[model samples]
Target chain A: MAQKTIAGVNLEVTEDGYLENPSLWTEEIAKEIAKEEGIELTEKHFEVIKFIRENAEAGLTIRKVGKSGIVDIKGFYDLFPGGPLKISTKIAGIKKPASCV
Target chain B: MKKILILGAGTGGTIMANKLRKSLDREEWDITIVDKHKTHYYQPGFLFIPFGIYNKQDVIKPKANFIPAGVNLIYSDIDKVVAEENKVLLEGGKVLNYDFLIVATGTRVDPDETPGLKGELWHKEIFDFYTVEGALALQEYFETWKGGKLVMSIAELPFKCPVAPLEFVFLADEYFTKVGIRDKVDITYVTPLPGAFTKPKATKMLGALLEEKNIKVIPDFYLESVDNKEKKIKSYDGLEIPFDVLTIVPVNKGDDMVERSGMGDDLNFIPTDKHTLRSEKYENIFVLGDASNIPTSKAGSVVHFAAEVLFDNLLCAIKGRELRAKFDGHANCYIETGFGKGSLIDFNYETEPLPGTYPLPGIGPFGLLQNTKMNHYGKVIFRWIYWHMLLKGKELPVENHMSMAGKKKS
Candidate 1:
């Protein structure tokens, strides 16, 4: 059980740096996490982060996020580069999607 | 009762056993399938083992588990197939006659085919990810490995899962980055192909991916031999690439039995009709999977699609009816680009991989030729499907032929 502190808040995280309790997530914590991943948060990143947090329990996928009207397929890639859904959801404070390989 | 003998109880053999047993009347047909080994492997899972994504337990299962009821499962080494007399010779000199024979003895990576590949450095310095032993060995090596010049090469083309070498490099990039040593490592992908992949469209996109990751591409290098003493691989045209650790996809060839049986091409692959999957030399025999010399990417998806057509054509052959089911060389594979994202590609004999949605038009849950986490999930989910629905010979939702409904035609 590794713990990480972000934005003055402490939370449990997995070996891969994903939040164990996504409900502990906050906008300030999201900014800190994204900064750690070498991303500077913008309005475009927040749109995907907000969408994934709202639908986190629904097993949202990259295609679902791209089709959710927040972003297109290429737009999703442009925002997050490599891991759009996984990184976005992690920033939004959600359990890592099980379907992601 | 007529006897039907199927060689090699791998993916193709297992599916054929289940499909044929259900189609043929038990009173009139006796089904028997044979293989050299008893353990069935999810070969695509082999690619993930070195990356620590899958383990030995995840990829291995008993061959007897999926072998359907009413089919005689024989576990032994194959000696040769006597197509002239329609009989098979086992290693112990036992003989079994067959009314219909199916050869599915898939391809194997032969390190011996390449000079110095099996030398002293073999599994220690030089590793291959094609087999379980190779993959596990590489896993152990990479665990404590300090980063340096890591070179990945393909000794030849027409290997199993053509996209696998590219996937290996992609996953390597992600793995090293996670371990915080990405800057310390230099990755190079050396291939015999002109680009990253076989098709034109896929090569362009995948090649760009290699560049983006800073993995150098050394294309059109025909491997002459591995110089273990110098710690470098020499190409035929005298290009040498040095490596701290060398991973290779060795020369793949059909089973040695195909060569001794005298029913194969120069590489021991059986001459199979591109569309019909029937033996070019014999009418009562059929070839499927990596054993057939079909101009398609030899992957599990190809085997699954070919099985559908082969089952129909085999049934028609038994009834003395004109064979009609066409294979169309439909093959698809998911390219794992690591970081929990993957890409999907779908193509047949005629079409190249295009950018669009797949298995549906306009409103796809899975995108094709585009890297997405959904495609990555689709790739991982296939392992379960391979074990359950595919080996059981149940129909999948995807059609057996290629469709252009959602593709961008340019």
Candidate 2:
């Protein structure tokens, strides 16, 4: 089924991430979610990607990170100098771009 | 001439100092390790203290005994770390400069973070196992009380040894059982999280155990205020969890100096690279243990594993090379399930504690997700590992990385 609109969208996003191959889209979904969170891409996504991917089997949800969103984005920016897109995409299962090295 | 200054001669600082000392030649580098306290603690042993398994004498020894022979050890409280200047100011009127600094200063409990916790009921009706005084006092209270509403709780998240609360409950069950009042006492576990643990498998397993033990599990209860006058805990959601005796894992924060230095997250944890164990903000600084805001459980084992990766990365830093070594937040812990049995979980950033044998898949020893005596032995024997191997930064025969070896696969 297609995603429900508006209020239902957030709940549907969770099911969408859960039903999809999380290892494949953990980065993508996390990035898309970060978009909704009013944040841009940065190296910080790498940490959350690995954390979410590893925790997927144990149910570390984007909703959960959003709920406990005490994680400082600026702190993350400081943590990884790599751009968020590169970090998120890589942890999302993309190869490390040569420039990142 | 490069000068290296290490703050907090505790587990993290001592290990980093030892590791760096081995890498930096004495002729070219000068290393100084500092802390106000002379005694070092096997903090993991703090869990066993309440059960009368560990005493003050057993858990502490001289910090000087652990520092390497050549490294200079300074006994002083650090005022702050000036990252821009690459210097640390001590409690005295002395300023120490360094070419590079490692902030291995780990964390401790701040019961004051919550109102009335440290106020009236501290060490009386309310207690924490995170410290020696709290655990020892709780032990005395445990013996004195016949039985009442005993609530085991965590004030907030990000506590060291997340499994310690579960272990406390399991052992509390046996403690009540041994005291011959298991039937009289009521055990209720309250937490901010929605389950018995952060991991689902362990929660389902432990939730079932709580049922078997007749213990109540209250999930998603954020503590709003502690009513010491009434001896009850009020949640933001307005759900009240009442108790005759309260055991809490108070809110944990990174060392205060992290805040003073202006190099920490809101919770005062240093911002560190999750994979490389390098400080993302400052190239010269490296953080390990509870000092970093890494998502891994702030257990000693995570530090033990991160130490090796940090060791390799620091070498790269010295050579002006890229930090190639990666840390996956590998933390392995044994969850004691009471009686003579326990559960073992070995996992990394992406893996959960699956049902499998550990370190050697399909092996004869150390079963995962299942309770066994060998795992119980692993829990008890970790004391030896913490003292002789971990604090010294010695490599365990096991791989520094998490292995899928002994784990069972579907």
The candidates' DockQ values read 0.01, 0.05
Q: What tens-digit string does per-residue lDDT give for candidate 2 at B1-410? A: 78888888877888878887877899999999988899998787777778777788888989998889779999988889988888889887699999878888888899887777886888998999988888899888887789989998887767788888888988889888998999989998998776787676767777898788788888866565789888999864457888999999898888888898888765678878889887879999888878887778888788888988988887888889999899987988898888878898888887776788877768848888888999999978888887788778787777898887776555
Query: Candidate 2's error at A38, in angstroms?
Result: 23
Tens-place lDDT per residue, model 1, B106-191, is 99999997789889998898999999999999999999889999999988657899889999999999999998899999999998
Model 2 lDDT per residue over A1-101, tens place: 33423323332323322222233344455556555445565664565666544443322322233344544333433333323323343334433221100
Model 1 chain B weakest 10-residue run by lDDT: B192-201
Task: Give candidate 1's root-mean-square deviation (CA, Å).
Answer: 19.7
Q: C-alpha displacement of B300 in model 1, angstroms?
A: 0.7
TM-score for all predictions?
0.80, 0.83
TM-score winner? 2
Strongest candidate by DockQ: 2
**Model 1 TM-score (2 dp):** 0.80
lDDT of 2: 0.75
